[model samples]
Target: MNQLRDPCRSAGRTERGRTRARNEDAFLDCPQHGCWAVADGMGGHRAGDVASQWVISSLAALPRQSNFDQRLKAVRHCLRILDSRLGRALPLNASAPYAIMGSTVVALLLEGNRAACIWAGDSRCYLWRGQRLYQLSRDHSLQQQLMDTQRLTRQQAQSHPAARSLTRALGGRQPLMLEVLELCTRPGDVFLLCSDGLYQGLGLDALGRALSRGAPGQVVDRLFTEVLRGPAADDLTAVVVQP
Candidate 1:
């Protein structure tokens, strides 16, 4: 197997339009090993910001390892530990109001010339090679479930009332079903991990065009502007990694 290679990376974040109380999104930068991540918190009645912060901090603090499998295992272990901590800290009480507190995570790890990515919830990871764009993560949202049952079209799901309702997330009652992807790396490849807030306004075509035409910073700035045009429903976070 080919090894992963280090890549230059950049990241950015913003809060949504309507919600002023909290910005519940997080991201990390690990340039030394070409690792980057973006996490979006479940926003409602609970402290979603806290959940996002804990998950991001745990992933960022993972010890560096030489082996790919070891590194991946460490990442998974860290997430599990965070889940347990959150469960202990914020137990749900049926007698009380809804206490939903969890986060969506998407991360990219580069080793030698190969790359692996893991994701949970709706936060997304995408790969851009040449002119083609590939989405690496699957959403754990209710709209996705509807699509699976042929009850909603992709376009309808985008604006569904329950679009934000996630089926899985870190800190939830059940263990998160993490999605992982492995890909070959090349020098000009660009990987993006971002919250739904960033992509809800702009489609893949617009994102791909922006990435192809500008630097990472410029792309993020433009994307933020586009998202701000819509109702600010949640926090927005993005991480752009290029190799």
Candidate 2:
């Protein structure tokens, strides 16, 4: 086996926000494993915080792999196992959103110069390069569906009452089908993995400026500062990574 050390640094933060009684969000910031993630537990569901914590802990517990593909497969398989367990344990009903537990996840895996973003639901992965911000993950939500299939503008799609409704997530009704995007890393690339609350509160301009700082800790601090500056009605989590 060819073992190579992952050369990356990361920092993370999570908040329950002003209105939420408990934080149902979790994060993993392990640069040694070259794995970082943000998981947002489904709001209005029972044991939301526990669901998110399970995701973070499961990923953190994965054995180190010699290569990116091995690590990526481990992540997918781990999540799939958890999803099946949650489905049988919770038996969620679409009509009763609060009766079961689930979560949305966005994970970033790095090895050498290669990186992959794997995600489900609305949690997002973003890249900051050449002074521009690019969202790497497309949300699996009704809002995104409207924009994609109906060709509606972002504003138009968001106007719908179910715009924020998740179309896919861990422990959802359907089998897990995680979306993955792989890319070659650049010398100055900055990546941000965050829950919906973080991005929904801050604009792209603010996020780009924060990531432009080029240090994981500083970028995470800036993000938290910006998001908490206004009304924060939901739990928020963020993991910032730089290589």
Which candidate number would show the highest lDDT if scored against the true structure? Answer: 2
C-alpha lDDT of all candidate models, in order: 0.77, 0.89
Regions more than 4 Å wrong, model 1: 1-7, 16-18, 156-160
Q: lDDT score, residue 116, model 1? A: 89
Instruction: Write the residue-wise lDDT of candidate 2 on 140-185 in tens digits.
Output: 9999999999999999999999899999999886889999999999
Q: 86-178 in candidate 1: lDDT tens per residue? A: 766766577854565678888888876768898878899888888888888888888998888777798888687877788878877687677
- TM-score of each model, paired residue for residue: 0.89, 0.95
State the number of backbone clashes in model 1.
Answer: 14
* Model 2 Cα shift for residue 150 (angstroms): 1.1
What global local distance difference test value does model 2 have? 0.89
TM-score winner: 2
